[model samples]
Structure formats: structure tokens, C-alpha cells
Target: MPSNVHSEEEWARLQPHITKLYSDEAKSLKEVMEAMERGYDFHATPRMYKHRLQKWGLDKKYKEKEVIHMSLLKKQREALGKRSIFFVRGKEVDWEQIEKYLHRRPDLKTKIRAGMLKMSSDSFDIVCRSPSPDPILHASNTLQYTDELLRLLDGYYVSSLSECPSGKRVNKVRDYAAAIRCFRRLDQARTMILANMLEPGFLALNKSLDDLKFVVRDQDATLIFYLCDVVTIFDQRHSPLVVELLRHTYGILQITFGESHPLVWLLRRLILLPEIDRYEVIATVVKAAVDKFERPGVDDRVIERLKCHYFLLLDHMASKGIKTTASFPEMDATSMDAVSVAYLGRFADRLVHSCKFEEAERKSDLMLPWLQNTANRQHAAWPDLQLFYLHVKAHGAFTRGDNKVGEAWLATVDQHAGRYFPNM
Candidate 1:
């Protein structure tokens, strides 16, 4: 028999059977062409086959593909359960009957008994559906169900930091954290998982928190806060992870609430925890960055921006009379302050640029006490000279009734000009 040549009798006999097989499986015309080439026998009349295919919803181009292999069918049956149909070496086989012959694992048995898993006639039909009847409640309940599933899976899958490579564990933890974020129940999720993690897992959890800090949504603030609370609780027992988690959570809070936000107050308290060296290293690093780098486009600026943010938070706290032991030295022009007076002068310049005359004056006022204290007491030549010059210029400007000019002069003198003036 030639490939392209066929008798009318042969065509009439085979075409109908081919159409019936294609129609039974809902295969499209193109799929039918491909299947026939793959050895499907067509034996019925063409018209009857076409009518049957259309009646069975198999005539459309988009109809689902036919299952032609038993192995593929068996795998799907195991994953999706006994309701699947199988075609074993071109012969149709019942999936439910096959399951009866195979021994199931205890876990699989438990899932079947608990209804956590289900069987379906089609793979698509095995999808988890909402238990809620009401549309609004269904959406909420669906989220809750997803959260529980992740929580359950996390226990078995999320490895401890010590038990796995740091990179792999960190990635897993971050993925779990992200999953928790999606369902709006991160706090409950964290609480459920935190109870499972021992001391060693804290490091991985901290790394996960660090990774998630940037992606946290506003709705996750409570979760971030809850993580911070957990860190605080374990601060003494697990100083390193606690510190890292606190830092990460603080960063998240800063982004979500901005510097002047009250959440910063909570962060300040966390930063000042007793076991943590809040003032010595972390505060110093923050101060240096804010004073040096956190401006418009300096590439290495996150540390500095964070530092400046911390300073603004401190300023906000002071304005509200929140007595915090965490103190940073004021920047002065002539004194050996942590930051140079030249920088203070620049900061004052920015205040002037913003047309913040009063703010500029207050900044100068902040420097005044230091200058006045230095002037009235024993001081170094440079500081004394700077203080006297600042006083003279401030007084001269005040006398002239140009308060803004006076404030600018005061800021400059306190910051730089005083360094050139000799003590009078």
C-alpha cells in the first residue's frame, strides 16, 4: 500500500473509526491528522464519525489532547488519584482498578482519609476549590487555605541553617517568607514556624528577614513588628540573629513608615536593647553615612541614607520629648565633633535653600549652646576662636535685624568661619 494512495472502500471503512477515536478524546482536526499518522485505525463512516465527535464536544480546535500512553496516565493517577483514565499500549485501562492493586504509603493513605487530597476524572478537575459559598467569604477563605497549605509544607521543607548550605537555606526561608506575605497572614505564619525553629534555625530566619526587608508590603508591618518582638524575646539567648533581624525589621519599618513615623520609636527601642551595642558601633556607622553619603546620587549611599533617616528619627523623638538614652553628638564648626563644622555649614546651606529660615536658625541655635559653653569655659585655641567668631557674627546679624542673615552667619561661624578667628 502506497502512503498517499487509498481505495474508496478503504477510505470509507477507516475514516469513520479514525474520527470516532479522535472524537472520543476531543482531539482537534490537526491532532486527528497527527494521531492517524501515529497508527490510530479509522474504521467507521466519515459522516457518523464527524457527527459523534461534534456531539461529544471533541470537534473544536481547542479541545483537550488525548491521553495515549499508560505510563503518563499512571503518573497522573498517582499524583491526582484514582479517577484518571489510562490508555495502556493503545488499549484503554481503568485507573481505579489499577490503584486497587498498588500498595499506598502511609502519608498517602492519611491524605486520602483526611480528604486533603482527592481523585478526579480529569487532571483539571483535581484543582482545590473554595469551601465558602459566598463570593466575598470564598476569596478570604481561599487565602486562608493557601496560607495553611504553605505553613504545613514549610515544616517539612524548610531546612535549618545548620542542616543545609547557607545559600540554599536562605533561599528556602525567603521563599517561605514571600509565600506568607501573599496571604496577609505573615504574623500567624511566623508564629507557627517560629515555634518549630530551634536556636540554629534563627540564623536562617534572620537571613530570610534581611532578604524580605525590601519587598515587604505595608500590610506586612504587623508581621515585621511581630518578627522584631520575637527577636527581642530571644535577644539574650541569640544575640547575633536577634541583631540581624532587628536591623532588617528596622529597615522595613523605615521604608513603610518613613523616618518621622512612630514606628521609628519602636525601632529605636529595639536598637537600644541592652545586649545590643546600640550606641557604639551601629549608631556610629549610621551617623557617619548620613553625615557623609546619603545625598542625591552618591552610589554607596544606603548606609548614609539609613543613618540620616536615623538622625531625623532621633530629632523627631527629641521634639516629642521622648527621653532616649541613645544620643549622637551634635555637629559643630570648631569643636572636635563626630562630623566637621564644614558639613554643618553645608547642612545650614541646605536649610537656607529650602527657604527654611527658622529651621536654619534653630540649627544655629543647636550649635549655640556648644559654642557658648566652649567660650565660657577652658577650650582649645581652634574651638575658642570658632566660638567667639560665631558669637560676634550672630550678635552683629541680630543687631542688624536680618535674622536670616544672622542665622546663616551663626551656622557658618559655628561650622567653619570660627576656625579662622582668634579668641577675643
Candidate 2:
């Protein structure tokens, strides 16, 4: 076919071949055109190729600023003794290319290092609490709280270090210990909250009372607490104390780690949830963040996972009788990670709680294959998730007046319980 005289059917027929040549083989336009002409007697103009590539979202080239921003993020991650991999516009960035750009633009490198160049959403400002102490409290009292928190943090750090920690784990323990201590002081809590939401272990579905004992001294159920309890303090949203504590903790995280750090981004979303009252506002924030997520120096999977969590959050609000015109965000669980798969199970439960049993059953039904396929099925939490899903199915069946099906689901749940938790 002539280059300028191609039909829609011809382009459709050639799409796969052209895709393989250009995207899969990473061929230039000239090479792709030459190969197509030589091999398939197909011809296309460069303008057509460029338009198609853009339309297909297969364009691999980055703007100059994007390269510089990605390089800066790489440098920031490496300085924190972490490995950074970048994917922008659906293409993996070459490290050698970033290095070449940095070498040529020494001034840009200096400006990035000095935190002057604003490149992406990865750059965040630290928000500090007001300098003045609360009117009810004295400066000395505030200092006392800070001093006590530091002492506790130091003790935790020492004990954690004594456990034969090495490398990044030690640093993580240290950073989280400081963040925890800051959280305690900001919340004005005499007893320490055992759960740190920032800690990956807290995301486990199988944690029990025994797991929470390390955070508080008392065995009393009343004293053990999670970060959310501290943030909102039992339906006491929009309190000055909550606002102050959240801001202070946010600042502690931002200052301890730079803006582009993964922990900071995680903390940002965590803190954002409680501060914003409206679901619409929260959804907008999430959409914006997800839109810019490609170059935010954060993993795309992590961003999607967070979006799932935000959906769960909004669902929880609606279940609590909060009026909201905003629709919840939908997720494509087919390609989601383990965290997201687990969240889907929770979301199904939320649906059940909302009395949307049919939707709950459908979501729960979709979860089984994803659960089985995920690498997390090997973890201790797997059985717990299984049990939860089975119970959800049983509840949905019972709600729909199908006693036989409900009993069958319960029997399966019991079987799992017997196998996974014999003592219980």
C-alpha cells in the first residue's frame, strides 16, 4: 500500500505488526517503516506513525524536564540507601541516560540537590505547628512532653537495635520509632499507641490482641489503640488537637525524610484522609495524585493500592450515614497486588455492612482467584482473609434467605478455621 493512501481496515490489519515493530522491538520510525515496507509491503508516513504511537500511549520519549526530575528523584532515593526504579509515560527510564543528562547539566544537578527546582508532585513542603504553645499549656510543659517522648523513643530505638538488626531494617525501625514518639506526644497520650499505620506489618489481616501488646503496657483492652483512633479520637473530627497532631506528625515525617521519599507519600495520604471531610474532595485529591503518579517517584502499584484504600474509606463514611453525592472509586482487581486484593476483601465486607449483599457477593466471588494467585497466600494472614471472605459469603447468603447456601458457606468457614486455628 502507498504511504499516503491507507484505509482504516489496512491500519487495523497492520496494528499488531506495527505494534510489535515499534513498541516491542523499540524501533525508530524509520526502522519500523523500512521493516514494514520490506517485510509486509506496508508503508506509512512518519506523521501517521507518530500520531498512532501517541494514540496508543506507546510513546517512550520524555521531555528534558522530566528526565531531570526523574534523575533528581533517583539521587534522593539512593541517598536514603534505597534503590529507585522509574517508569514514566509507561516506559522504563534508562539510568545511563539520566546520568548523562545530569553530567551535562551540572547547574540543574546543584539546584535539584539544594531543593530549588520544583519538578513533580513528589516535592512537598513541611507544615509545622504554630510556635505558640496552646493557651491552656505552658512552654515548659510542652518541652516536658517533647523531652519525655524523646526519652521513650530513645529507649525503643535502643531495644530495637539490640535485636541484631542490620542495614535498612534498623533505619526503618529508627524512623518509625521517632514518628511513633511524635504521634504520642502530639496526641497528648500518656500511654503509647501500639499500632503504627506507617509500618507495613500493620496492614496484615491476621493481627490479634497479642500482636498489639507491644504498643501499650497495660493488658487492658481500653488502653490499646491504633493511629486512626489518635487522629480522629472517636468521632471527634475537626478538633484542633487532631489537626495539630496530624500536622506535627506530617512535619516530623517530611523533615525526617525528604519530600520525594515513599514513606512521606504514604504518610501524606494517611493524614489526608482524616483532614478532608467531604468524599468529593478526597476523590478529587486521589484522582489528581493518581494522574500525576507516573513521575511522583512512587510505584504505580502502590498508588493504585492507595486508591483502593481511599474507596474503602469513602465506603466506610457512607455506611456510617454520612451523606455523599460522590461515587466511590472503582478498581481493576485483575492486575492488582496483594495489598489491593486484601483490600478488596475488606471492601466486600463494607458492601455487606452497607446492606448491598448482592454486590458484596459479587466482589467476594471475584476475590477468590485473586487471593489464590497472589504471593501473599503463603503468609499467615491468608487463612484469616479466607475465613473473612467465607463469612462474608455466608452472611450474604443468609441475608438473601438462602439458609442452605449460607450453611454451606459457614461449613467451609468452619473447615478453614479448624485447619488454620486448631487451638481457637
Candidate 3:
């Protein structure tokens, strides 16, 4: 057995391997301890043993370079503003050189540096918390500084990734998310930032969505949903940023989760803005869905559910007095044809339920003419035709106060009712 004099060192040297062993094979710590004891060799010091392990790529040392760099950068920034003639090593210096020096530092001090970077307590408690802060002046200055910092950080992170694609250095995605959260908090700090034209905070939020998209598969869906909810609250209906963010979000959903994913429902809720370019966002989602599920034996239920969702979106638009256009900028003729058929079918069903026979007939006339104009249109079955006929007749009877005729029409509907509308 190895002597107990070096047991602590041995334990430290073996710590990483022991952790890996336990993780890779799900072994108990006690089992790892026993195994290490059984294979003990007493020729070297613990330091030597640790060096050997590290040399063999079996151990790693925790480093804090990023934290240290951030701290020095913040301190330099504060000093440049406070002291008129800042000097370093017998020469006067500027803030830019101080920042460059900090960035090039070998060791980072994370926590201390981050603390230094935080806004002063006096500023937070007095300037930000005051009920009557100069909204326009404060917002203009803060937004300018925040936007410059964000752009600089974005470039830095991108450069770092480009230099080493597989480099397991800093967690850039997590850091970006944190920065976005910081901007969001700042935006919430005052009403001034909310109404500002720069919209630095909202742009940061959109970048957050992009970062989330990059690592969404590894992130919790519930957390993403919550973040999206917060975004909706911040991005009121009139905000133009809402449309751009929704477009990015739609792309994220397409690559990370399929159309049937429940998170898509949350996204759908967020894009319920009347002033937003609805067709643009919806068309992106529809194209993604069609491309993802164009297999030979696709699930019929999934297709139907997607169609139902589009129908509901159209209904919502119509209710808001927004006209539905046949032309979408992003969709081709063939794609538009598929979407139109699905939308019209649902519209007809809704009219049937509302007992609007004349309206249903009018929509059918409008749709049939377009459907016929398409070069390679899909055929509608006789049963489908008869179903609409009976729905129209039922609506006519309901309007005329002929309960007997309405009942007779409903009996025919029952004979043809599928699983979806079984009770109806």
C-alpha cells in the first residue's frame, strides 16, 4: 500500500480520474477509492504524480483568466474617467491601451473583475431609482455606451470562435446569454430606455434569441418558453423589433424543434400582433414544416394539426378586420396553393359551426374559382362536396327558422363525420 504521508496528494492527483471513472461507468466513489488503493505505486511524490497525470491528458487545472481580464478592463475604464492624466510605467496612458492590456492578460480574475464592472451602488440607488430622472438624456447616454459595448463583445466572441472552432475555452453562448440578460435588466431599469429610439436593449434581446438558437438543443425548453414570454411583454404590438425577433424565433424553432413541438404554440402566441407582417413570419414556419415532414409516410395527424393552426391564425386575422391576401412574398405559386386549400377547408368548417350558410357559400365560390385556376390541382372528393352542401343547407334552414330541415341536415353530417368532428 502507498504510505499515508502522501495520501492527500494522491487523492488530489487521482481526483479527476476518479471523477471520470465514476461518470463513465456510474461507479461509486468508494469503489474508485478501493480501485486506486489496489493499483497504488509508491515511487513518486504527489506533485510528480499530478504532473504525470496532466502530461498524459488525464487531469485539468481550473483557470480564471476571463474574470481577471474583465476586472482589469473595468478598473482601467473607471480610472480613465476619474483621473485626467492616468500614468502607467512612467508614461501617460489612455483607456484604449488599458483595455488592450487587460484583454491580453494571461490570467483572469472572474468574480473580483465582474464586481468591479458592476454599476456603482450610488448610481443604481440614486440615478436609476430616482422617480424623476432625466429620461431622454439618461437614455441617450446609456444606450450609446451599452450598444458600443455589446457590439465589441459580439465581435470578440465571434473572433474567438473563428480562431478555434472546437476550443473548449470560455462558454461563449452562456456568456452571450448573460450579456443579453444584463441589457434586458438595464432596459427594465427605467421607462426612458423603453421609449428610446436606439432600442439597444431590444436588439440585445434579439441577439439572445440568436444565441439560444445556436444551443437550443442543449437548453431547457421551459426556460426558452419563459424567456420568450418575457420578450413578448417587452415587445409590445407596435414595436417593429417584434417582427424581426419573431422571424428569427421562427427560424430557431424550425432548426431546433419540429412544427408539432409544443414550444411552437408559445411562439404562435407571441406573434399575435395585428400590426406585424403576419404572412412573412407564418410563411417561414410553413416552409420549414413542409420541408421537415415531406417523407413518404408522414403522420396524417401532424399534418392536420398544422393545418388547423394556420386556420386559427387566419380566423384571428379576420376577427381583427385584417384582410387575408392570396399572395405571400416568400411563398411560390405551388406553396401558396397548398396553404390556400388548407385555409379554405378550415374556414368552411368554421362557417358551418357559426351557422353562416351564405358566408360559407360565398367563401366556397371564391376558393373554387382559384382552385380551378391552378395547373395541377388536387382533386376534391364527392363526399367532400356533399359535406359542404349539407353544411350550407343546414345554415339556410337555421336562418329560415326551419328546425326540421336543420335536424335532417345534421343527420346527414353525422353519417359523414370523421374522428376530428365526431361530436359535431
Candidate 4:
């Protein structure tokens, strides 16, 4: 069997299966190949797959220009008080890139809306009728529109960062802060409008709020830290925007100052923002970062950090009884930093609370060096380690029938309780 050769009988047998997977299920070419091998024990070369797909008219992708044309036509319909929906091969267009193009070509907007200019392509249809089960399609279309609007807003935010003059970023940021408050009000109004209409209105609201968070990340490298602190103080909630800003800050500092930079580690820990069932996004990002740094011969310190965060996130989710299949990665703690150690300490404390004393004790022993160091006591995570160690020691002593030692450790925690938790 040559690589490019495929028999007529084989194609006749597998053609429908391939079409179902490639078109209906929307799997990529590689994924389709892997699925075929696993499910049908069929093996084919890429060229064979491509040739068969072309011959059978299974190409589902919209060309870049076709997408541009569809987007423009869609916008043109919107201007004329008519809705124009588009689908390329049974899926929606990539609204993000289309929105970027619309933002980049403001001059074309007037010509397009006024019907003076148009783009023609055969790759899509100007769908006049609504999709079947109209309400569901309406909700989806609403979300798609909201996401596009949010991206356009982000583009404006990036422009503000780019167009600001030297020595006046302070004023510019101050104005931006004020503008965000107004934007929030407008967001509230938009939410109200949708809330009156449908049950999935809050989904749109959440999407808008989530998208607003990444706007601050488009800053010049120098102003990242200052702007991050300001935004943190300005919005006292654990908002998605702050997490995205921290992620952006982490990338910049990791590149400019290297992985060993304290700010990099801080941002690494701070960047953990996993939504419900969306923790894989964090894992994927961290793994990619690990690959990027490893390609340059960097150590696996970042992996240690990722493992700690992953465990802590799992613990947090477990406490809420939200189960996930994400597992803790195997980690080496020989050179773990204070922040990473703190995350492990927090995880250990959760284990202690769950009555997993033996594992908690092991974790305490792992942090013994950092716990005993006087200088480490001044570190921010020192109290977390201290609390974890004291709790584990008390639990261990009580289990071993050494009541006095357990009481002593308990006494130590009570003695320092005020200092460790003054507000509590």
C-alpha cells in the first residue's frame, strides 16, 4: 500500500465515517486521522486524507478573505436594520478576527453601511432566515455579538495605551479609570436590557465582565506594575480582569527579567484564575510556558510552581465539592521558592482539615528547612508554613499519644494567633 494510494472499496466503506467526523463533529484533520485509527483501525497518510477530502468536498474552513467579506456583509445588514447571520460549513465565523478587522478599517465602515462598497464571495451565505429552534440560536447569536463588542472595546483600550504621550500616562490612566466607571454603568444598562428579554442574560453579563479584565494588559512594559497596583486598589473584587492583567504581567516580566525574578513568581501565583470547568485553560497556558522556557535550557522551577498551584486549585474546588479530573503533576521541591512553599503549605492545611494527617505531616517535613530559617520568617508565606507545621505537629503528636507535646504545639498557635491573625 503506497502512502498516496487508497482503494475504491476502502473509500466507499470509510467515506461516510470520515464525513461524519470531519463535518458534523468538527474534528481537525489530525484528530480525524487519530479517531479513524482508534475506532476503525484505518491508517492513511496526510496526503491521502487531503486528496479524499478534496474529492469529496469536505473542506470546512472559510478562507481569510471570505471571512472578511462575510463580516462586512453582516455589518452592512446590521446598519440597515436587518439581521444577517452567517455560517461557514455549519459553524460560526471567528468573530474575534472579524472584529479586529472592523476596528482596523473604520474608513470602510461608512462606505459599507451606506451601501457604496461590498465584498462578494461564494464561501458563505447571507442567511435571511433564523436557525431552527429560534430562541437557542438567538441566545447564541447574542453571546457572539457580545463577545465581538467586548473585543472591540479591548481594541479601544489598546489604542489608549498606544496613543498616550510620554510623561502623561498618569493623566491618561486617571482618565481611563474614570472612563471604566462609566463603562461599568453602561454594562449595567446592557445587562438590564438582556435580563428583560431572556433567561441567559446573566451569561452575557458575565462574558462582558470577564472580557473587560484583559484591557489593562495591553499597557507598555514599563507601566505594567504601576497600572496593576492601581487597578487592584481601584477594583477591590477578585475580578477576572485582574487575573488577566497579572497573566500579561507575568509574561512580560518572565521574558524581560527571567524566571528567577521575584515578580515573575508573584505573578505566576497570582495568575491562577480558573472558572468552573475552565481550569484546563490555566493548565494549558502553564504547560506552554514550561515548553517555551525549556526550549531555552531553563530549569523546571516553573513546573514546581505550576504543581503547587494545581494542587491548591484542586483543593479549593474540592472544598466546594466541585469534582474535576485534573491531577497534580509530579514535582521536585528541592529548590522550591517561598511562594511555592506557601502554596504547598496551604494545600497541606487542607489535607489536615480533611483528616489526612499523615500526608500533612509529610508536607510539613518537606518545608522544614524553610520553616526553621529565621530570614524565611520575614517572608510573606512564613505564617502559612508556620500554621501548617504547627497543625501537623499537633495532629501527629495526638495520634502518637503524646498529649503534652500536642498541647504545647497547640499553645504555640494560640500564643501567636493574635499576631498571625490580628483582624481575626
Q: Which of 3 and 4 is the better model by TM-score?
A: 4
The pairs that clash in candidate 3 are 64-108, 65-108, 67-109, 67-110, 68-108, 68-109, 71-113
Assess candidate 4 and give its TM-score to the true structure: 0.32
The predictions' CA RMSDs to the true structure, in order, are 24.8, 23.4, 20.8, 26.9
Q: Report the lDDT tens digits of candidate 1 across residue range 1-424.
A: 3244446666555645454545435565566655665674433344544664454333322112222223234334433212334343344444443332122223443444344553444533222211221122233344343333334223322322214544543222121224222221222223223444332233334444544553444222123223333343332333444454566677776776577544444454545434423322233333332443334443332232233335433432332243345433354334423122322332343344335657555655554544456443343333433443354445445544789987897687556633443321
Descending-TM-score candidate ranking = 2, 4, 3, 1
lDDT of 1 at 112: 43
The per-candidate count of clashes, in order, stands at 9, 1, 7, 1
lDDT of 3: 0.41
Query: Higher TM-score: candidate 1 or 2?
Result: 2
| Model 3 C-alpha lDDT per residue in residues 169-241, reported as the tens digit of each score | 2222221223223222322221223434233343344444545554444432123322333334333333444
Which has the higher lDDT value, candidate number 1 or candidate number 2? Answer: 2
Determine the C-alpha RMSD for candidate 3 after optimal superposition of all C-alphas. Answer: 20.8
Candidate 2 lDDT at 344 equals 66
Error of 2 at 38 (Å): 99
Location of the lowest summed lDDT over 10 successive residues in candidate 3: 124-133
CA-lDDT, candidates in order: 0.39, 0.50, 0.41, 0.49
Model 2 C-alpha lDDT per residue in residues 65-184, reported as the tens digit of each score? 676567666555433323556666555566676665555446766787676876576533312122342324333444444344334333433443325334422222111122222222
Q: List clashing residue pairs in candidate 1.
A: 14-42, 16-44, 17-43, 17-44, 18-42, 289-304, 333-341, 333-415, 386-418
Candidate 4 least-lDDT 10 residues: 170-179
